[model samples]
Target: MKRRQTNTNFFDLTNLSGDIRGGAISFLVAVPLCLGIALASGAPLFAGIIAGLVGGLVVGLFSRSALSISGPEAGLIVVTLSAIETLGSFPAFLLATCIAGLMQIGLGFARAGMVSNFFPSSVIKGMLAGIGIILIIKQLPHLVGYDADAAEGLALFQPGGFNIIEQLRMSLGQFSGVAMLIALSSLAVFYLWGRLLFQQRAFVKNVPAALIVVLLGIFINELVRMVFPQLALRGNHLVQLPVPGSPQEFLQLFTMPDFSQWNNPLVYTSAVAIALVASLEALLSVEATDELDPLKRKTPANHELKAQGIGNIVSGLIGGIPLTSVIVRSSVSINAGARTRLAALVHGTLLLICVVTLPTLLNKIPWASLAAILLVTGYKLARIEVFKGVFAEGPAKFIPFAVTIIAILLTDLLTGIGIGMITGIVFILREHYQNTHRVRTEHANNITRIHVSLGDHVSFLSKAKLLKLLKNIPDNAVVEIDGTGSSYIDSDVIKAIENFGVAACQRNIQLVFLPARPAESPVYTLTELADNYRRNNSERGFRHDSQPHLHRQVNPTPI
Candidate 1:
C-alpha cells in the first residue's frame, strides 16, 4: 500500500474559501465553550479567549494536525479549578500553567507522545464521565442564577463545608425564574437546532447551536428589560468581558504569571497534572481527527505536543488557561469542510477580533445560556449510552471504569486515575494467571493421563497455578506438559516443573516435557529427574531459584 502524502502547505490558498467558512462556523461553536470552561475554571473570563487565540495561532501554526482545533478544554476545567484554588491565586496558577508548558515541551523532546497509549480506554472514559457529572453539578448554580460561587473551584464538597447536594439546595432558595427561563429556552434551541441538522438544510447546518443559544439569551434578557425591568438579568448573571477602548488597555488585560511562585511545590505538582492530562487529551483528539480527515492525513504526535506546549506557554504568560486539541471544535470544523490549518488560524484571528471589537455585545450574553451549553456537553459526556456501553464490556472493563468515576468524584482527578491504573493492572495480572495454560485430564484403560498446554507467553504469574495443577495429579499417572506454543516461558515455571518431577518420583509417575522448540522435547522417568536434581544440587550448590539445568534424556528411560 502506498503511503498518503502529508503535503498541506501553510501558504496554499487553494482552499481559502473552504477554510474561512469552516473557521467561521467553528468560531460560533467555540464562543460559548470557551466562556463556559473559563467560568467553570474560576479564572478571569478573558483567560479563555486568550487560550483560544494561542491555541489557534500558535498551536495551529506548529502542529501537524490540519483540522484539529485547540482551545481551553472542558476536560481541564476540574484541573484548572483545583489548581487555582490550591494555589490561592490566579497568578500563582498561571505560574503552574507555564511550568506545565515547559513540561509538555520536555515530553515532546523526549518523544513521550506515545505515553497516552498506556492509559486504558476504560479509565479515560470513566474520567470523562466523572468530569461530566461534576460539570452538571457545578453548572447547576449558574443555571439557577446563583452566581455567588461562580468563580469557585469544582469539588463534590467545597472548603466551605458545602457539598454538591447542599449547593443545589442553596441554589434552589436563590433560584431566579428569569434565569431558569433562559436556560430552558437555550436547551430548547439546541434540541431544535439538532433536529434542523437532520433535515439536511444548508443554512440550518451552517448556523451553530451555541450561537443561536447566545442570541436567544440576549434577546430574552432584552425583552425582559423592556417589559419587566425588575426581572432582567444583569451584573454576575451575564457574561462580563473587560471592554478596552484602546490597544494599550487591551494589552493590560493580559496578566503575567507570578514568577515568585517558582518555589511552591504545589505549583510543580499542578503543572505535572496539567501537562499529563493535556497531552493525553491532545493525543486522543488528534487520533480522532485523523480518522475524520477527508485526506486521511496522519498527525505527527510529537510535533503536536511541541505545538501544544508552546501554545500553553503563550497562554500562561498572558493569563490564559491550559489548552488541548478539542474534538468538538475539530469535528465541527471538519463538518464545515475545513481543509487546512488555515481554518484554525482563521478561528483564532476571529476570536481576537471579536473580543477586542465587541466586548459589550459579548457581555450581553447571559451566564444561563453558557451554562445550558455546558449542561448539554456534560450530558453528552456521561450519557446513559456511555455507561451502558461500558457495562456491556463486562466487569473487566466496567469495574475499573466505575471505580475511576467514584474515586474522581470523591477524591480528585490524579488520585482517581492512579487508583484506576492500579485496578486495571490487577485485572490484567489476574487474567494472565488464570489463562497461562490449558489443562486436560483423561482416564483410559484404568490409567490416568494429564496434559497441560502452555499459552503463547508464560510469566511468573502462572507459577502458583502450575504448581497446584501438578500437585493435584494422582500417583502412577502419566503427565505431559507442552510448551511448544509458548514463545517465551518464564524461568520460574521451568523450576516448578523440575521440582514437580522430583516429587513425582516418589509417586511413581511418568513426566514428559515439550519445550518451546519441538526438537528439544524429552521423555524422562521421575526417578532419573530426581537423581539429576540431587546430583546437580551436590555439584553446584543449586538452590530453588537457581536455573534448572535438566538435560535431555538419552532414550525412554525406566525407573
Candidate 2:
C-alpha cells in the first residue's frame, strides 16, 4: 500500500520554485499594507514589518496550517492605538502585547481554539466575500493614484464620517493618468495570463504574473521619467519604504517592551483584550484558509493558536505590533500557488532582506501595480460562482452568507461575524423545531389514528413544537407517541409528554406513550418493539387514562 502524502514537508524542495514566486509576490503585497497598518495604529512604521517577520518566520514554522500567513492584523489597529494611548507609551503597550501572547498560549493549552468549530460554513464563506469586497473598494483609490487617505483605507468609516464610496468619488476627480495607466495595464496583463498562459504554458506559468507586472510597471515608469518627466509616477504614487543608512540606525528600529509597568492594572486589561481579539482573528483565518486550500486539508486549530501566541511574544519583544493570521495575505499566497509553509518563511525572509538590501529597488514599484494585484485577488475571492453555489444550497445557507457580507460592509469584521453567527443559529433552531418529530394521521370510521415518531436524540429545543403538536390532536382520536428510535430524549420533552397524557384524558383521546429505550436493554429493533406494544394494547383494549396501567404492565424504559 502506498503511504498518503498528508501534508507538505517543511523543507520540501519539490515546490521551491512556486514557493519562491508566491513568497516574493506576497512580500511585495505585504510591505505597503504593513506600513499602512502601523501608520493607522500610531506605531513606528517598521513595527508592522517586524510583526510580519515574526508571524511568518516563527508562526509559520510551528503552525499546522499550510497556507495561512500571519502578520499585523488591520482589525487590531483600533485596539492597539487605544492601548498605546491608555498606557501612556508604546513600550508599555508592547509589554501588554507580550502578556497577551502568554494568555493566548494558555488558551491553546486549554483547547479554547476549538471554539472556531462552532462557526457555520456559510459565515466563513461570507467573511471571505466581505473581505474581498472591502479589498476591491479600498484599493480603488490607490489604483487611481489618490494617496491622501492611504493609512485608513481598510477602515469602513473615515474621520470625517465619509464612507469608502465617498472616498472613491472624491478620488476619481483628482486621479492621475499615469497611475491609471499602470493599474489598467497591470490588470490587462493579469487577465491575459489567467486566460491564456496558465493553462497552455508550463515554464512561464512558474513565474508569477505579479512579478511580471511589477517589473513592467517599473520599466514603464522609468521610461516615462526619461521621455516625459511630467507623466512619470513619483513620490507618494510609488511604494515608500524607510531605509536605514547605518547599522546603528537599523538597531534603533527595534523597541524593547517596558517591563516596569507590571504593577499597572491597565496593562493587564489591555493584555486580556489583545489576547481575545488576536486569538479570535487567528482562529477565523485558519478556518478561512483551510476552506481555500486546494488539497482540502484541515488545520489543527489549537496548534495554530500556539503558533500565533509564540509569534506575538517574539513580535512584542522586538517592538513589533500584535500579530495574527491575516486572511488577505493567506489568500494572496494561495492564489499565487504557495504549496507549503516554506512560502511563508520565504516571504518573511524577503521582508527582512529586501528592506535592508533593496529598499531603493522596492521604492520604484508603483502602488497602482500592487492595487491591480489585489483587485484581481478580490474578484477571485468574491466570484459570482461562489454566490451561485451558496444560493443553490438553499436559504438556510445563503441567508447567513448574504447577511454576513452585508453586515461586514456596514460594520466591522467581528460584529459582522457575530450577526452571521446569530442568523445561522436561528436557522438551526428553526430546523430543529420542524424536524424533531414526524407526525402522521389517518382516518378510520368516525375516529382518527395519529402516530408521532420522535427523532433520535431529541433536545429541549423541540419542547415547544412537541407541546403544540400534542395540543392539536382532535378529540376521539387514538394517539401513539413512539420514542423507541431516540437514543437520548431530553427531560423537558419527557415532561411535555407526561403533561399531554392529562390533556388527552380531558379531550377523550386515547394516548399510548413509548419512552426512549434504556442503556441496558436487550438488542431488539425499535420497529419490532413498537409493533408488539400496539398489538398488546389493542388486544387488552385501552381506556382514555390507561397510560398508567400500560406503563405498569410493559415496564418500558423510563426515558
Candidate 3:
C-alpha cells in the first residue's frame, strides 16, 4: 500500500549513458512487435506505432512501474476486432477507445485496479496461454506468405487471430513455397541463436534475436528475388509501412474519431468491454513483469491503471489503437538491462523517428520474419514448461487452468475468463465445505456419540453441510455441536440449529451444542434447547459425565 517512494526526481538524467543503451535495446525489440500487433489488431500499421510512442512518452513519464512497457497487445485482438465489427467503423472504434481511457481513469480513482488480484493466477496464465496458442495458429498463413485475409489480422479468433480451418485450407492450396522456406529458416535461426548466444555473450543476449531474424528474412527474400524470381513474395507478404516521403505525406496517415457516433449504444458497449479487458490485461502484465524484475519492484496497480488510461487517451486522440502494459515488450526491456522507465520512452521515440524517416528500410522487413518472431513469442507463452508447472499444482489447480485455456480458444477472452472463474469457484467452495468443520461418530456401550466441531468464521456457506450432518444423527444418539473455536457464525446456520434442536425430540436424539463465549453467540441458545428437551424428558433415563457442558440433551424413546 505504500507509495513508490523515491528520493530522486523522476526525470533526473543521472544515468544518461545507461538509459540510452537500454532504451536502444528496447527499441530494437519494440519495432517488430508494434508492427505485428498492429497487423494482428486490424488497425492501421501507424496506429501501433503511435500507441508505442504515447505509451513511452506519456505513460512512461507517469507510470511508477519502472520496468513495464505499454502498447497495443495481442491479448486484446479479439476484443478490438469485435468492437470494430460491432461499431461498424474504425473511426467509431477510436471513440470507444477514448471512452475506455476515461473509464480506466475512473477505475484508477475508484481503486478498482485490485480486481486483477482476485483472478486466480492459473486463470491468468490460461488467458495468456490461450492467446499464445491462437497467436501461433493465426500467424501460420502469414508465415507461409499466404495473406488471404491480410487486412483482417493474424490472431486465430478475430481481429488479429481468426479463421483457423477455412484460412488454412485456402492458404495450403495457394501457398508460397518460397515464403515458407524463409519462415522455416528464420525459425531455425531463432532456435539456434538463443541457444548459442543467450547465455554465452552479454552483448549478443542484450541485442534482440528478432533483429537478426528480420535481417535474415530480408536478405533471404532479396536473394530469392535475384535467383528464383518465380518463387519471390511481394506486396503484403512483406510489411507495408507506407513510405511517406514527406512530412505532409506522413500527416495523411492519421485518422480522427467520429464524434457523431457518441450516441450509439454500441460505442459505449465497446468502451466498457475495452475498459474491463484492457485493465485486466494491463494489471496481469504488471504482475508478470514485476515478478521478472530482478530488484523485485512492485508496481502499484492503481498507478498502472492511471498511466495506461492517460496513454490510451493520448493514443486514441492521435489516431492510435487502445494500448495496455504488455509482457513481451516489458520483459525484453528488463532483459536488455533497463534500469528505469526511460528505456520505454526511448523505444516509443525511436518508433516515431523510424516510421517517419526510415519507412523504406522498415518496409523491407518481411512479414514472414515477423511471423517467425511472433511464432516464437507464442511458443514461449504456451511453453511445455508452463503446462508442466500447472499440472504439478495437481488436478484441483490444473482443471481450471486447462478448462480456461479450452474455453478461451472456443470463445472470446471475456467468456473464457468467466468459465475459468466459475470452475475455480467450484473448487474453492468444495474446499471451504470440507474444511468448515470436523465430524466424528463414536459408539461406546449402548450409547452413540456424534461430534461436530466448527472451524473459525463459519458462515452461511457452511450451513448446508452442517445441516446434513445434523440430519444423519442416529436415533437416541448424543450430538455435540461445538462452536467454541468459531469467532462468527451466520444467522442462517443459527436458525438451522434451532430448527434441528426442535426436531430432535421426535427423533429421540440427544443434542449437546457447546455455546461459544459471547453475549449472544449463535450457539448461546443451544443451552436453551438442551433445557427444553431436559424438562420434557425428565422422566427418561439418561447418562451424563462431569463436563458441565454448555448443551446436553437427553432423551430415551420419545413420549
Candidate 4:
C-alpha cells in the first residue's frame, strides 16, 4: 500500500523533460514581474532575484507541492515597503525578515498552519478581488505610458490631490503614443489568444500569452526605432536590470542583515507581521494551486510552512526580499504542464542566467507590456461575475465577501483581513447560537405542544437561549425535551434543562424527557467526558461507566 501510494507522488520525476520545459516557460512569466515587484517594493532589484532563486532552489527542494512556484510575491509589496520605512534601513528590515523566517519555522513545528481553515471562502474571494482592483488601478497609468506618480499612491489620490480620474484626464493630453500603441496591441494579442486558445486547445494554450506579448512589444519597439525614430520610447520606459561588469562586481551586490537591531521593539513587531502575512499567503496559494493541479495533490500546509521558513531564512541572510508561494507564477507553471518541483528549479536556474548573462536582452523589454499583462491578471481576480456568484449565495455569504473587499481597498492587506476575520467569526457564532436547538410550538387536540429537539452537540454557549425558551413556554402546556439526536451535551446545558423541568411543573406545565438518559450534572461535563475519552474512547473498551445521580427509572446514558 505504501509503495502504491508512493507511485502517485506528484513530484516523482518521471516526466523530467516536461517539467524542464514548464519551468522555462514559467521563468519567462517570472522575470518582468520580479523586476516590477522589486521596483514597487523599493527593494534593491537584485533582492527579488535572490528571493526567486532561494524560493525555487531551496523551497522547491523542501516543499512537497509539485507545481507551486515560490518567489517574491505581489501581495507582500505593501508590507515590505512599510517595514523598510519603519526600520529606517534595508539592513534592519533584513534582520526582521530573518526573524520572520524563524517564526514561520516555529509555526510549522507547532502545527499552526491549520489557521487557514478558519477563514470563510467568501472572505478569501473578496480579498483576492480587492487585490485585483488595486492592481488594475495601479497599472492603468503604466499601461497608458505614464509613470509620474509613485505606484502606491497612484490609485485614489496623489499627494497633490490629483486622483486617478485626474491623471487619466491629464494622460489624454500628454501620454506616450508609442507606449499606448504597444499596450493596446499587446492587450489585443492577449485577448485574441485568450478568446481563441486559452483552455480550448491543449498545445496552443500551454504557450504563455504573456511571453508572446513581451516578445511582440520588444519587436514593435525595435521596428519603430528603426523606421519611425521620432516615436521611440526610452529609459525607464523599459526594464532596467543592474548590469554587473564582472563576477567581483556581482559579489559586491549582496547586503547582510544588521543583527544589532534586535534591541528594537519595532523590529520584533515587523517580524511577527511578515511571518503572519507570508505564512497565510503561502498556505492560501498552496491550497489554490492544488485545486488547479490536474493531479489534485494536497500539499501539507505545515510542511510548506517549514520549507518557506527555511527559504526565507536563507533569502534574508543573502540579502533577498521576503518570499512566498506566488499564485501567478505557479498558475503559469501548471498551465505549461509542470509535473514536478523541477519546473520551479528550472525557472530559478533560468532567472539566475538572466541575471548573470542576459541583462542587456532583458533590459530591452517594455514596461507598458508588463503593465498590460498585470492589468489582465487583475481583471481575472476582480471580475463582475465573482460578485454575481457571491450575491447568488445570499447575504450571509455576500456580506463577508463585500466587507472583506471594501476593507482591503480602504486599508492595508493585514488590517483588511483582520476586519473580515472578526466579522466572519461573529456571523459564524451568531448562526451557531441561533441553530443550537429547534423549538417548535404546535397546537394538537386542544393542547399547546412545545417540542424541543436538540442538535447533535450542545455546549455552554447555548445556555441563554435554552433558558429563554423555558421561560416563554405557555402555562398548562405539554413540554417535551428530546435528546435522541444529541451525542454529547455540555454540563451547563444539562443543568439548565433539569432545573427548567423542575420549575416547569410549577407553572401547571407537564414536562418530560423523550426516552432520554440522565446524568449527574457535574460528572457529565465535556471536561470530564473529554478526560474519560482521552483515557479510553472506544466502545466496550472503557474500563468504567459514569455514575449519574438520577434514579434507576431514568438511568439514561449521557447521550
Per-candidate TM-score against the hidden true structure: 0.77, 0.90, 0.80, 0.81
Find the 10 residues in a row with the least total lDDT in model 3. Answer: 550-559
- Model 3 lDDT vs. the true structure? 0.75
- Runs of candidate 3 with Cα error greater than 4 angstroms are 1-45, 74-96, 148-161, 196-198, 228-230, 255-270, 288-298, 327-343, 442-446, 515-559
- Report lDDT (CA) for all predictions: 0.77, 0.82, 0.75, 0.76
- Show model 4 residue runs off by greater than 4 Å: 1-26, 36-42, 78-89, 148-163, 166-170, 195-206, 259-270, 291-296, 332-340, 440-446, 514-559
Q: Clashes in each model (backbone N, CA, C under 3 Å)? A: 0, 0, 9, 1
Predicted candidate 4 versus true structure: per-residue lDDT over 2-52, tens digit per residue: 533432354555676567767876676577666667777889988888888
Q: Is candidate 1 or candidate 2 better by lDDT?
A: 2
Best by TM-score: 2
What would the per-residue lDDT of candidate 3 be over residues 410-446, giving only the tens digit for each residue?
7766678789989998988888887888866667788
State the displacement of the C-alpha of residue 395, model 4, in Å, after optimal TM-score superposition: 2.2
lDDT of 2: 0.82
- Which window of ten consecutive residues has the lowest lDDT sum in model 1? 540-549
For 1-559, candidate 2 gives per-residue lDDT tens digits of: 1112434356457778877877788888888888878988899999988998888889889887888888998889878988998999999999999999999999999999889999999999999998898888888888888865545334465355338778788789878888888899999889888875465988567789898899988988999999999989988778888899998999999999999999999999999999999999999988999899887777888878888889888999999999999988888888998878888999999998888889899999998898888898889889999999999999999999999998888878888898999999999988877788887776768888777778886788988888888788888898887776777677677667656665666677787656445534443433334455456544333332222223212322221
Task: Identify the runs in model 2 with alpha carbons over 4 angstroms from their true place.
Answer: 1-5, 152-155, 158-162, 445-447, 519-559
Model 1 alpha-carbon drift over 4 Å, by segment? 1-48, 64-69, 72-99, 149-155, 158-162, 196-200, 255-301, 317-321, 324-347, 517-559
| TM-score, prediction 1 | 0.77
How much lDDT does candidate 4 score? 0.76
